[model samples]
Target: MKSVSYAGLTFETADEIADALLQLAAALGVNERSETVDIPVVEQNGDLSSVQLVIGPASQFISKPVTSPYNEPASAEVVERLTYRTRLLDLPRAAAISDSEIGRLDFDSPA
Candidate 1:
């Protein structure tokens, strides 16, 4: 079996990105346990919610190049590996959204 993961992010910039990702995963029958979802929130006064959520795989795999006599190939599988991770909310320097908005930080598709 192959191991892969998906991440779902939600921000004020757009309402459909997270929803689309969620749809993609569900349409593909992605194992919920394998996917991680994180949504960091900020406030207007440069304050943040005391609660931060981070969910993902236990660990990630590193890729190695394969050299073959006939051809050189990279890892059989891989995805965009993220490093120096952070949320864009910090840059906006906006204050926290309404409590209602905070609770709405889920990827929900419209029927």
Candidate 2:
């Protein structure tokens, strides 16, 4: 388990979930974007609950190790979605142009 501090509150959740959430937050920040996410958490008495967070360029998060006996929350789908969104914001790369294409461009002019 991990303790994730966001907004003004701290919540306990699975290690992987916390790590992925932080990573997604960073990616969004780099792209100057924001997203709302629902994270599953374990309450103090070991009850299951969730927290809604708005993460963006200005959002801050803190995650630390915590000991818990309960099983990690089932959140693989959430992780995958976060990863996909992060990938969508990847820096643009220049497209590769072939020598033949370059030659065509040089000769193709409107008369």
Candidate 3:
């Protein structure tokens, strides 16, 4: 198993190191192509060791959208209409009714 050690703490796997790096990136709001993490280690005799971790070329969570011929971009109006339709569909039937119409409901009557 690959591992990295610094400041008396040892990360015993690449996954662990990657997770830590991701957390660090999130905390720092790092959305750039790449980022470096420097881990400083100091020994009892006052010797220092620097461990560098190169994060990445922007993980998928922060990566920019790639343009492709297969994907045609939609106009702002179209996007807004689609979003509005989706939100309308997501609402409960009762909530979708207008407030003025809601007062006309016959709660004492059975369906």
Q: Clashing residue pairs in candidate 3, if any?
A: none
User: Which segments of candidate 2 are over 4 A away from where they belong?
Assistant: 91-111
- Native-to-model Cα distance after best TM-score fit, residue 30 in candidate 2, in Å: 0.7
- Reference-based lDDT, each prediction: 0.30, 0.87, 0.41
TM-scores, all candidates, are 0.21, 0.78, 0.23
Tens-place lDDT digits, model 2, residues 1-111: 899998889999988889889998999898888988888999988889999989999989999998888877877887887778778779695789998898768456675
Error of 3 at 4 (Å): 8.2
Model 2 TM-score is 0.78
| Poorly placed runs, candidate 3 (over 4 Å) | 1-23, 27-32, 43-46, 56-111
- Give the number of the best model, judged by TM-score: 2
Model 2 error, position 40 (Å): 0.8
Q: lDDT by residue for model 3 over 20-85, one digit each (tens)?
A: 444554533433334555544333333544456554444332222232223222234433443443
Q: What is the lDDT of candidate 3?
A: 0.41
Ranking by TM-score: 2, 3, 1
* TM-score (C-alpha) between model 1 and the true structure: 0.21
Candidate 1 residue pairs in backbone clash: 42-96, 43-94, 43-95, 43-96, 44-95, 44-96
